[model samples]
Target: MSDVRESEGLTLLGNQGTSYPTDYDPGVLETFQNNHLDRDYMVTFRCPEFTTLCPITGQPDFATLYINYIPHIRMVESKSLKLYLFSFRNHGDFHEDVTNVIVNDLAKLMEPKYLEVRGLFYPRGGISIYPFANWAHPDFGYAELARTRMFEQLSDLDRGDGTR
Candidate 1:
């Protein structure tokens, strides 16, 4: 992959001794040209080890982050994304805010045709918080897709089965 132009923007992928950031830093994200721009497909990332601090109590909040996006011209580099996500480890924010921030940052970075961020936070005070956010390029017809996915998420929550 070294000779591939798409791999040019990657920096943290194979590096050793990575230092997780102590603050929220969206600049840690990196992107590469999407090789399959002619095709429309979904890329999903399931991160089960996500953690951030609660805004009020400063206690650690654990969650599994589910990210889905349809690439346009660029796609995020995985290792750089991992670093960017980890940068929130010590950052303080509500679960809903964290989900929105992630989706917004990725949208700014890649300008994907569509993107969604869902955070499934662990139960606290006998209740669990699930935050879901999504965006789509206005020029494309992806707004409908985003809406559909949002509806599906809400429907899933209504089921109260908690399987997903």
Candidate 2:
């Protein structure tokens, strides 16, 4: 993969002795040119090991983050993304804030045609909080798609089995 010209921006892909960050740093994120610019397709990442500190209680909060995006010209590198997410380990923020911040940072990094981030936090104080945020380019017809997907996610969480 290193021989490919498109992989030039990747710095952490196959490197040994990787170091995880101890605080929130958006600079850890990296991206490469999108190879499939002619097609509009979704790329999804499931980060099940996401963790951070709660702002109010300073307690550790755990979540599975679902990131979906439609690339424009650049795509995020996965190893860099792992390190970037790890940077939030010691950072403190509310559930909603964390979700929004991630989406905002990723949007700025890739400038995707459409993007959405959903954080499914573990239960705390007998309640679980799931925050979802999405963005779409005004010229694209994706704004309606974003709204529809949001409703679908909400419906999925309301299965009445209390499993969300």
- Give the whole-model CA lDDT for all candidates, comma-separated: 0.88, 0.88
Instruction: Kindly list the per-residue Cα lDDT of model 1 for residues 1-164, writing each as its tens digit.
Output: 65563447566767687777889999889888888977999999989999999999999999988899999998998988898899989999999999999999999999999999988899888789999999999978998888888878977777664335
Candidate 1 contains a number of clashing pairs equal to 0
Can you tell me which runs of candidate 2 are displaced by over 4 Å? 5-7, 159-164
Q: lDDT tens string, model 2, 42-136?
A: 99999999999999789999999989999999899898999999998999999899999999999999999999998889899899998999998
Count steric clashes of candidate 2: 0
Candidate 1 lDDT trough over 10 residues, lowest sum:
1-10
Candidate 1 displacement at residue 15 in angstroms = 1.2
- Model 2, residue 45: distance off in Å is 0.5
